[model samples]
Target: MAVLSLKKSNLPSVWLFSFQVIFLALFVGLKFQTGYDWPIYEAHYAAIQRGESFYLDFEFGYEWIVQVASRVGLAFEQFSAVVSVLEVAFIAIAVRHFFPRYCLVVMAVMYSVPDFYLIPTFSLLRQGLAVSIFLIGVCKVFSGKKISGLVYFTIACSLHYSVIGGVFLLGLVYIFPLSRMTFSLIFAAAVVLYVASFDIIRGVVEVLIVYVDPKYMIYLDRDVFNASFAYRAAFAVVSLVIFTCIYSAWMRRESSDGDHFDRGFGLLSYRLALLGVLIPLIIFGFPTLSTRYQYFFAIFVIGCSLGALQYVNYASRIMVVAVIAVTAYLPFYRFLSSPLSIVYIPYQSQLFYDQTNSTGHDRTNDLLNQLDVLWSK
Candidate 1:
């Protein structure tokens, strides 16, 4: 009987390991991808190899990796390929505590996750690395490794200053031990604030910009309700489900022995996730500068969702999984049916580039003509 129990537990772990390995292989096998920022990152890495003074455009931590690759006599392409795999490894470590099956399911379905399969995934190089580290750090903090988590957070900041926003959110988690009622009241105030005049909201955004680089002023714009009502309604529905999962967690702590789940971290991460998701929807009318916070927000939600699952009764488990699955599906469906049929029409990759380049075909024109088809009758 003991051996049988062990076998059951080990089966999921083995499957989880296989899932991680497959993801690493798929991402690393790519020699090139067509994210909009690929050319920019390609140029930046070349400048580093040439020993040009190019640190102003990128952070030192990112440049440091390119420099090491240069010294090791590897091309920027090879280095970037390997580093992409490493970032995924970091995320795996970050969510190691979650039931591997659930984590794999989420990763497979959730395109919003920066590293998940998508063109946008490749667009963020430095920021993606920073987010990977910060996620692991938050998980570590939740697991009671405060010092280790702080070290990871510091490393994240070194990679990209934007991670400061994540750090600030974590700090708030520690400062304010929150409750469901607190979140409720806060959301109420946010709606009130949302109804206020644009001048007032713009002033709030202005105050926020002061905390970051003034150069970001270039990205800030007045928020617009550009999406259909259905899209907006989806956001509200998802938010409510997340709030319910989190609030139910508080109830679980009060009723159960608390050994089956790690509510402390679940609560901390959920509070951060809630605020992260809420502020962007409530206050920042447009997801310009504030949009980056969504990645950080998503990580903690994964943490909370998985952590809560470990403890909830069978019936509660049904609701939690259902909520997570539906909430994740919304953004993913939007991605596939969007203009991607234009940008990623042929889903070109390094393999295509190699084959076509060998034949002396103009790859740029090929991509353009593919996109042109979507526009033409």
Candidate 2:
């Protein structure tokens, strides 16, 4: 572990600290938001409060946690925000030791990237917590702390067994030789298997069906999606480009710096970059399946891209800003224009409550006044 020193605590850390403060507040400040799956969450919270047996359909651990909290009468918004806080805290803790230079960048992308935030933080609540834990576990694994990684992975699996298959695949990829030839073969083979004829694909799907939870089997129909496949495909290509650039830079640095540079994360980044491509293709034919898997891939792309941003040097150290901008563009565009924009648009907060009701007062002032309350709570 590295020791803290005032000499080492410089401008970048100060800037990152400021960014963390603002980002944490923005992310965790939801005040009864009304969008994508909020109705479902509200219903569940209500049921829990009313002492009804619910969420029996989902993971037991998550269900129990929410039920217990609801029994104690916590506000849903505040409780959900606590989950977000844990998500950020875990990631920050992992990166603080391993990727100090890029911790803020990773945290920034993990929160700000549109699809990443929209899907996990705003919609897939339990899975959001799981994925955050999963990423922390991944960081530990890549940092050579396999035992710690296993602990995190185990907790995540308990929350959402749905993504355990993807995690298995990631483990397989990671244990394989970290060479260009091996990666090429894996990527090519995955693409071939995914793009094969319908009969062959059907056989593969049948095999996967047996292993998948029976609950998700209802989403197996192949006719539930279209055009959006192209969108995900394009996003994958963009991710690939960004990852490759960062990876190439990392390789150069590793060659110069020898064992001092940890390049495994770079390798992991590109591997996920490829998965970003493969997942869209594999799930494209079914909207249900696509959405079921969206949470995993969104994390892959955002986490990988943000990790890579550490090695990237666009405009010579302005790369973080560039990466942040690029990370936000797609999600922001979708937030405004997509048919599903209702899932993420119309940002909500108690600060805006008065203004939203035409009270004719300053939202900023309201927010400022409530800051002490917010922090104290």
TM-score of each: 0.77, 0.71
RMSD of 1: 5.8
Runs in model 2 deviating more than 4 A are: 1-11, 18-22, 181-203, 206-217, 228-237, 258-278, 286-315, 319-332, 351-377
Query: What's model 1's overall lDDT?
Result: 0.60
Error of 2 at 122 (Å): 0.5
lDDT by residue (tens digit), candidate 1, 11-95: 3455555565556545544646455456567777778778886645677787777788888988755776676676667766655
The global C-alpha lDDT for each of the candidates, from Candidate 1 onward, is 0.60, 0.57
Q: For residues 1-377, what per-residue lDDT tens digits would candidate 2 score against the true structure? A: 01111122332374555568456645554534634555567678778888786654778767877877887778777677777667656656654544555555555555665555666666677777887688788777877899998998888877788658758767766676356455456545544444442224445666797787756555454233434544544454554555455455446655766875545565565565556545545554554444545545454554444444444344443645564456446535545665445434456665554334732123333434554453354
Query: Which candidate leads the pack in TM-score?
Result: 1
TM-score of 1: 0.77
Residue 127 lDDT in candidate 2: 79
On the 0 to 100 scale, the lDDT of residue 96 in model 1 is: 50
